[model samples]
Target: MSDLRRAAEEWLAQDPDPATRAELRDILDDDQALADRFGARLEFGTAGLRGELGAGPNRMNRVTVMRAAAGLAACLPSGGRVIVGFDARHGSRRFANDTAAVLAGAGLRPEVFADPVPTPVLAHFTRAFDDVVAGVMVTASHNPPRDNGYKVYWADGAQIVPPTDAEISAAIDRVGRVDALLLGAGWLVHDGAGLYLDAVSSLNLGTPDPGLSIVYTPLHGVGRDVLLAAFERAGFAAPAVVPEQAEPDPDFPTVAFPNPEEPGALDLALALAADRGADLVIANDPDADRCAVAVPGPEGWRVLTGDEVGGLLAEHVLRETSGDDRLVVTTIVSSSLLRSIAAAHGVRFAESLTGFKWIMKAGGPPDVAGERGGSSPHRKPDRLVFGYEEALGYSVGDDRGVPVADKDGIGAALAVAALAAEARQGGRTLLDLLDDQARRYGLHATAQLSIRVDDLSLITAAMNRLRAAPPARLGGCAVESFDDLSHGEDGLPPTDGLRFRLAGGSRVVVRPSGTEPKLKCYLEVVLPVDGDIAADRARAAADLDALRADVAATLS
Candidate 1:
């Protein structure tokens, strides 16, 4: 704590920026806030730094940003090209430009996007530039307005993984202060958003019904115009904008959390759906890399979980492809329904860590096309044919055959609405089709329990409590086996998580979110159905209830 305090003081003393100095003043005056904001140096883990925006060593300020950029530049191999992108956040655009300047000063060529763009577009562009060894995106995704992030991607257009993260972090540690370096002019800026839109347009293999009433909200981020343009270029109807969230607002006033997966983040979009009787509601986080969706349900409007949407989209992508060596990908934290769905279609299924970066790696090159040739970076199996996480990220195609491995929320939204239209033509709802999927490939029910903590130590304590004493039983079923993810028992690298297997193919996974101060418990219960759909649904629902109670009892 003293070392951290000293570091904060040193930066505070020299910070010329008025805003940084003001934030530093606040930190010095408020002991608790100081403890919270400067308790530790902001972590630059496997995914790099993301935290509340403020002016402390532990916050997302100019000092930390410059230090990180310098470290990244120093860590990169000599002669490597670096690409940068930013979202619509408080200091996102400035941070991005500053990072490029820092990189250029370090003698590395920095290719920066001209304006605020989605993280996924940066993901795609990372691979487009030859000799590019690393990529950086300034975004906080769905976090509160006061939060910002620096997501580092590797040369492969995927977020930095494993040894590279440690390597980069070590480089960052070597930098004593933010003022130690002088930056040079960055390379000529590129039209990253235009390229991203062009790529998405080329991946329109599925026929979208132009008549379907679609509503879209960028959730006050950078994706509104690009997404709308892509929809139109793909021969799909232009989406109705949720007037309140149509324009980019760093404050994100309508929602507490900008993530669409959150219960009420899509309230405005859902309300719009209710008012227009729109066929579907589509929402993207501030940067537009992740998408949130809503479908008109029997009870007002129902928001679909990321897994349900992924599984449904996976099925759609497979149906559109003709590859014999088809592979569908998702993260382990996501629902296992995709596995069963993939198996039924004779397609291979692969699981990675809970990030689109991992899924994109499993799918292959970010810029390569899938079965069909396209220039966008979102193509599925053929390139990155289809990949998603429970956190609402979906990348449709690749850039070479398609272009980049970036997630295309706009493309995914169009695909979902199109699929719903096809279902409507068949006299069925998406839920009805999902029921059919369940009946064909056993009923799959998945749920997540997330526990938020105010302190870092509390988070560690919760994980320690779980590991020191494993659960004997859950949902009335005996705990068959348990695996500590930290030990890498699942043929994957060690991660801070735990997985428990039940007696009847049921599973529970407990892990702290890498980017958020929360513990997440994922539950998957399978219901075998030979002839009964109603009974299967009832059994799955009951299983979820029991599992929820068991988790609550254990965690609480």
Candidate 2:
């Protein structure tokens, strides 16, 4: 018999978990499936373990999870306390318990969230537990139904970085087999939602406007209760929830991918908005850390891109809390309009490598101690109050004022409502305000071309091809310079990506998605708007479309 078949038979013989044994029985029937599942253990990269569920070391099954938990326990500070949280994804809760049990068996006290919740809540709890040395959140934020992930965070509440990742990986390697775990009940449960909301409330975007009407969708995940509670607590009129997606369903019945960025995912919310003439539509992915917003545009209700929403939010927040010490932070791949916007207000603008964990490196203050999250930016950036990324993650607060280092879709929605209300009070619409902002900021428009590939190697090949020989000219403009992120002085570890600057201030950035098998191309076209929103909007729209085509042609 083959080794995979032998392993499967062994698992079936010894596996006490009936469900796991049943799964193993089915996996053994298909030879190829059995091989795929049992061929090798799930490898831990800098990010941690993420794979589909099945009955092998290669899958996210009990055996694999326990092994990973054993490695984590081995790596923890000697007898250090650890906290764990899980989302509403399938098997996440079970994985959480398995992790705690494994850690407890290693003589570490593990505090777990009592129920499935959003990732941000986990992030908050990671910090709230002062005695804790590390944290784990089991979620594949915004991925499709069949997908799930495991992410590790340090005391700073950010995802694990560098030597820590390497150390944990080594320990994981030492755990050579599934049976290498000690299981026990040294696990304590806590209220993650309450703690997470308390942190979010502290970053109150002043107040929500009663005049703004909103249709919010949780996308059939765990943000329903926390988001609603946040809006209510923040003094915003309770948003009308999209009934079909108001509750947590691991199947995510309403949306195919459970990502609001996709067109079809927002259809229900958009339709509801149209029916109610609501001012805006807001959505959160399954775990709720990523947010998507739709606004009343001249072209009917439209969902804004992450860059647009992020730029507008920064602009509004800076305006509301204008101060000499204002600072705005975002990933290098995000819209450059934010730089100009920050420049306009004389606020400090800084760029971090992609990922909120990197952004969280800009940490908080000394006296305002709370949680052990990713390091803060500046001992608390003076008015260090806002950050975002193109992937729809955002943060708003002084490093020390509660833990919003992770994105909060519910919070973003409430802030947008307040901004919309203020605009309405001035007899203007969001589009009109956007036009004004763009005109002042030089009409910075951006678009992204995402290519999905089944094979991971193809993405690597594409990145290598672009890096070895980038475009000499794009969009009829000569290339002025190149920022090869793979080897640039960006003070970041080599990422496989390239950014090209065109002569006319237009730019294009190419990068592979760190967490998925996809190549991403981001393009920006700047139109100087002397006047006329309609004309400038039309010109910018055409320019963005042309840029999109240009990117597609170049990448293809």
Candidate 3:
């Protein structure tokens, strides 16, 4: 037999699922398919394993999940408790069970959520307990129906970062075949939803005024119950749930991609919002770790960019909460408006590399009492008030330091509802608050130019080309400065990205997508509001459009 055939047969032998065995059997005669499957495994990393589900190591399956669990077991302290949760995705439950089995077999206590839960709930459970060492969430967030993932949250309730991710990957490499690994089950079932809901209830900044009507959708994932429960607990009237997507469906029939950020994903919810005259429309991605908001305007209903939502929420948080040591954090690619928001409120602000892990790991208040999780013991601790990324991920820290170290769409929805209620009661809307921010701080407009490629080498080549000869001008504006982020600047760890600061207070950051096969270029335009929100917004939009085109051309 050929080497590929031999490997395929070997994988089929240990594969627990009869479905995958059949899949591998049929692919054995097809060299291309076999090569795709066995050529490369989905190596675990900071985000853990995520890929199309199939029979091979390259795909997410029982064997792959078990091996990853074993590797995780090796890195954790023996006998430590590990909690496991899953979303309503195909193979999610099985993969989660496999993970629990592996951890239990490795002599650690394993607690499995009895039902499908949102990603944020699992992270909350991971952090709620003092003894829980880490967590595994079986979900791909908003990936396509055919995909699944394994996400690891450390003791801090944040996604595993750097050295830990690297360590787990190395350990996975040493793991033997699944058949050789010991497995155990009958683990304790955890009440993650109940605990998470109560915690989220405490996040509501203000009483939800009855005047603020809202519509919500989970995009056919497992957030409906939790979101509804949270809304009720926060004193908000039950949001009109999109009936078509109210139930969990692994197929995600409503949208091509389950992500709320994708176009048309919110069409059903927006239509419902219109029917109910909802003041706001909220959506959580498949696993509910990200939240997307839509608002009605003179032009009709339009979804707000993550930055717009971030800005509006920041204003509400500042108004509702008090603390001179309060700190907020954002990513290099997110809008810079947050820094201004924090500063204007006499609060501290910090920036971190992309991802909620780094955001949660950000430095804390400079030596103030009552703050729990400020990194940089060397630097005085700053209480983290809030953190967000441009990708619809926000962590709104409550009175008790940051509860969910990772993004909590459920908590954010409550915050959005509370803020929207305040706006409605004050005879304003979310859009008005956004405009008010523009007037106080300069108008900050942001857009993204994402180019997906079939061949991964194209991304590497593009990165190389940009580095060899950086652009001196783009979007009719001179590039004021260029920084190769891979070399590490502004106290950020090394990462593969490029930053271009333009002369007109505009900027662009280009980097490969960490989760998808796309080159993502984040574009931002900053202009002082000229006392007219409409004209200022128009100019900002035009500038961003030109800049986006320039960036696309440069990258191509």
Which candidate wins on lDDT?
3
Q: What is the TM-score of each candidate against the true structure?
A: 0.91, 0.92, 0.97
- Which lDDT value does model 2 have at 311? 84
For model 2 the local lDDT of residue 310 reads 87
Off by over 4 Å in 3: 364-380
Candidate lDDT scores, in order, read: 0.78, 0.77, 0.89
- Between the candidate structures 2 and 3, which one is better when assessed by lDDT? 3
Clash number for each model? 29, 15, 9
**For residues 57-153, could you state the per-residue lDDT of candidate 2 as single tens digits?**
7777777777778888888776787888899888899889988988888888888989987888787777776787888889887877876788887
Ranking by TM-score: 3, 2, 1
Q: Rank the candidates by lDDT, best first.
A: 3, 1, 2
Error of 3 at 556 (Å): 1.2
**Which scores better on TM-score, 2 or 3?**
3
Worst 10 residues of 3 by lDDT: 364-373
